[model samples]
Target: MNKALFLGLALSLLPIGCRTSNPSTTTSTGRITTGQRNQQAQPFAKGADIGWLPQMEASGYVFYNDQGVRQDCFQILKDHGINTIRLRTWVNPSSDSISGHCSKDETVAMAVRARKWGMRVMIDFHYSDSWADPGKQKKPAAWEGHDFPKLLTDVYEYTFEVMTALKAKGVTPEWVQVGNETPGGMIYPEGSTANWAQLAQLINKGYDAIKAVSPQSKVILHLDQGNNRERFRTWFDNARSHGAHYDVIGLSYYPYWLPGNPDYQLSIDDLARNMNELVERYGKEVMVVEVGGEDTKPQNTYDMLVAVQRRVKAVPNNKGLGVIYWEPEGARSWSKYPLSAWGNDGKPTKALDAFLAE
Candidate 1:
């Protein structure tokens, strides 16, 4: 079966509170503080995509520290050594409980909070009102029925608008993904990989828009299945042939969600191999922008995370940027996501301790 089909099946089975009164050190011009500006040069990016956070908080899902004391969610994550926050933006998302409400406004607010917490930020553009992944890339409802040319304009304008909004709030993302897990492509038929030329055009529009607003931000083109070398080679080769512009290759690694739920040991080597090959082949930096293991198995998850980090760090000359857990704090009790690194007691699992390693 194709990767997209497997992803569809996998999904069919699947399902910060700390008030900081500290005035943000960010300049009124919306630029990061000098100290944060310097930290942007760090070689690795340890991150978590808390796109579901606002909703979780509004739903009254409280977070606690390892001591079991109620704490702000951001504090809990920072305590576990998380240094970056990834937020997903939807053009005009609804207020749905599980799969909605990451609108640009919400995203900007989240980015501001992340920066205030002294964490680097990554913005992921789903370009849809809801989830866009390997199996689906539905366009925002407003963009429906548009012609190819109009679609290109939509991509560029939407991207620019979001980037501009984030900038207005003094949150310059350190990294931006044009699309989320777009192995087949994004925005459906017009932007689908079925036509590499069109797909490249759509991707370039988002890329150009990002550079226009945040020239220093490293733009990432993301896809799922980090361990599948053939998938990367084929898709990226087509992208290169069609002149898709991007600064980095982003991948998602989820051993637990693979077709057969393989152990991380079985695929960690392949992920490393693919990352090294990507750097060698395209001369582009690579990052595991998304990763997770079974939250119930803390020790095993911890070991897998350490090994994954070791492999990424092993890449010569730091071409291997780093790994980002998808949503380590999205506790299963609240989100029904089995892959998070948080426990039922509202504390981070030992799995997140891997980041503290080395």
Candidate 2:
């Protein structure tokens, strides 16, 4: 799911002797060394992507509803050197209307809009009626009582429906996620167990759907709290044990949320270390699919993202694909108590200059 999730990655960064399917080789200094490196670190920004879709807009701004801002915003982002648009699809959002949450049609429209303006598109599937995140994983209304087999069938149908439509429209997705932040597992209890065989079936259903419809698209199995090396090791070990298939391993990194002492803040050094460990441990390609920081002056949160990126790029086995700000531009929370808070600009918040600067 787009809202539900979350990198250290490179394939070939491991030892030439002992081989894993997706190995990440490392140097003595701990900086990532790999033939599959995306780009070398430099002051200039390269190989990164940006976007502001309604579901995953780094800001979650409501300007999208206005139609005017929505149109202009797309152009504005493109004008600023942005080359991609990412949209999230919530399976059968409660209202069925594009205005209420996100839908397949709305995402296609957004993709059409972006394509018309020359930007590539990546569609995310949350497989739920509402948001899918580490904290809450809601099942879609249509798949209420479905068993694992039925659920997998629904996954294929729904995914095929969306991708098939996109292909016919000449706006096929450049990338598609099988499920959102599937840390606890996707489609709920059935495939939600720590069991890999069951979970792998769900993931494969999604992967198969994409390949059947959009063969060119890359599929991802995104996870959250990427900084925790052990958790990632455990998750991927389980996923592989279960036979899950995916092209990229997307991760969510929020330094503020990382566990530690009373402070628990992440320094640039910490970011580099954790991300580098990812490549050495998982070998799967990694992308910081979802990221965010608060909007205080000095761009406190934005600084963290910049630092994190810089550090990741500096890692010994760095592949440093890129990072995406998860709704950093969001307006306010969408819940009663207000939980839709990845990005908000109500207060005089700092702009995203920091992330852009470096």
Best by TM-score: 1
Which tens-of-lDDT digit does each residue in 1-358 have in candidate 2? 2332321122122111000012323232222345435544322222122222443332243433212334345554443344555667877764411124567786677678778987667778888876677766677888988777898899899999999888878887656788878878877777775666787887888888887776656677788777666667788778766667776677776654554511225444544566677666756556667665544323566566567667655655445556665543333332111111223333213334444456
Misplaced by over 4 Å in model 1 are 1-41
Backbone Cα, N, C clashes tallied per candidate? 4, 31
lDDT assessment of candidate 1: 0.80
Task: Indicate the worst ten consecutive residues by lDDT in candidate 1.
Answer: 15-24
Candidate number with greatest lDDT: 1
Tens digits of lDDT, candidate 1, 1-358 = 1233433333343222110011123332223355433343354677788887876788788898888999998988887788888888888876555555788888899999999999989999988887788767899899999999999999999999999998899988888899999889989988889988999999989988987888778788998899999999999999888888887799888888777888899999999999999988886778889988889999999999899889888876566777898778878777666788999988899999888883
The CA lDDT of each predicted structure is: 0.80, 0.58
